[model samples]
Target: MTSIAKQIERSYSATRASAKASRLVAYGIQPASRMVDALDTHSVHWRQWQMDVVETPLLEHFPEGQRDALVYLSADSDTTITQLEPGKIYIVGAIVDRNRHKGLCQRIATEHGIPTAKLPIGEHLHMLSRKVLTTNHGDGWR
Candidate 1:
């Protein structure tokens, strides 16, 4: 499960905070407004093998070069999700800026040369609104 507090948050606002909480609940996690640190190794999260994208002094979850990671489930991503790689870190960008910040994740991933993808939403649903989904919805949709 990839839910990085720092990588996804450009600025901390009440809207962002609420969206994060919703994502937490969607993942069956109780939302923590001020999660200072990542889950400990021996904590149940390690068993689940989680990682956060944002680099922070409080947490160093993923490795330096995330070659083993796959960032996906964006509204603007062109690549479609066809299969899941075993042991590959599949990270869904957590953004809730009300479309004011479009393609932010795509830009970041491209800057880092990280390949990005979106859920095969067209194949699954008739999009009435924007294709972007909250973190939890993306998590549960597949």
Candidate 2:
């Protein structure tokens, strides 16, 4: 079966480990940034993984094939998906770290031989903030 791979592996930063832990907690409680709570309103079934997804990779877990449909999404990807398709798993990178673990998601997908697509962010007006949208914003589009 084809599935979506969200290459959301965040390399641990030992020097900033304490700060990251606290940052994660802040992300959970803050409604504007809380992804799970927002998704609950839409009834989207999802799970929150405590560990790096790379350890228990989804590509290894699920059956694979082009016929089944396994695609991943990332800002680093060149391909774009304007509309989501049925029977396709849309893996959203779940890294809460703001450092833009740059290309980490795309790298993982490439390692798994999973295709990738990025949101059409260029058509919109140029904003002052960084281009990449929050996970909440991406999920809301669906």
Candidate 3:
């Protein structure tokens, strides 16, 4: 059986895979806003993986260099569900292992009719990228 965190991770990965084949875009919401800065300088193995695009930090618009996948990591305090667009997919993973505020984001998605996957625990950076590449894109902006 998969661990709770692994289960969440798998669910996200499966979602991303489905989206990639269908030409959909997906974003991974980071647990905290600080990840955004780290992602910009972080190394993503896009070339080695042969993926059209690799994970990325938040930007005004999705980068053209990396097509297909756009990973948007959100800060933990990002409570703006209104930013989501229709027909988009998003995987929200908390940066910390704590579950104190877990499911809050998923609940928000349900309330707005936005489809989302929730990771019970924080996942590694690479795992987060893999999840983003494979999930479907929702109608929302990161």
RMSD of each: 10.3, 13.6, 13.0
Please write out the lDDT profile of model 3 over residues 10-81, one tens digit for every residue: 443454555343232223424444433343334232123222332443232344443234223333333434
Put down candidate 2 lDDT per residue, 1-142, tens digits, no spaces: 0011121212112212334231111122223333434544432332353333233336555545642576777877889888878767666555532465777878988877888888787766365654576533433232
Best by TM-score: 1
TM-scores of all predicted structures: 0.51, 0.50, 0.27
Q: Candidate 3 at residue 80, lDDT?
A: 32
Model 1 C-alpha RMSD vs. true structure (Å) is 10.3
* lDDT tens digits, residue span 32-124, model 1: 423333333113333232222233321134334655464644667788877766655555555452568888877766766667888776677
In candidate 1 the C-alpha lDDT for residue 104 amounts to: 89
Task: Select the stronger candidate by lDDT from 2 and 3.
Answer: 2
At residue 55, candidate 3 shows an lDDT of 43
- Point out where model 2 deviates above 4 Å: 1-57, 63-68, 97-100, 136-142
Candidate 2, after superposition: displacement of residue 126 in Å?
3.2
Full ranking by lDDT:
2, 1, 3
lDDT, candidate 3, residue 70? 25
Q: Where is model 1 more than 4 Å wrong at Cα?
A: 1-68, 135-142
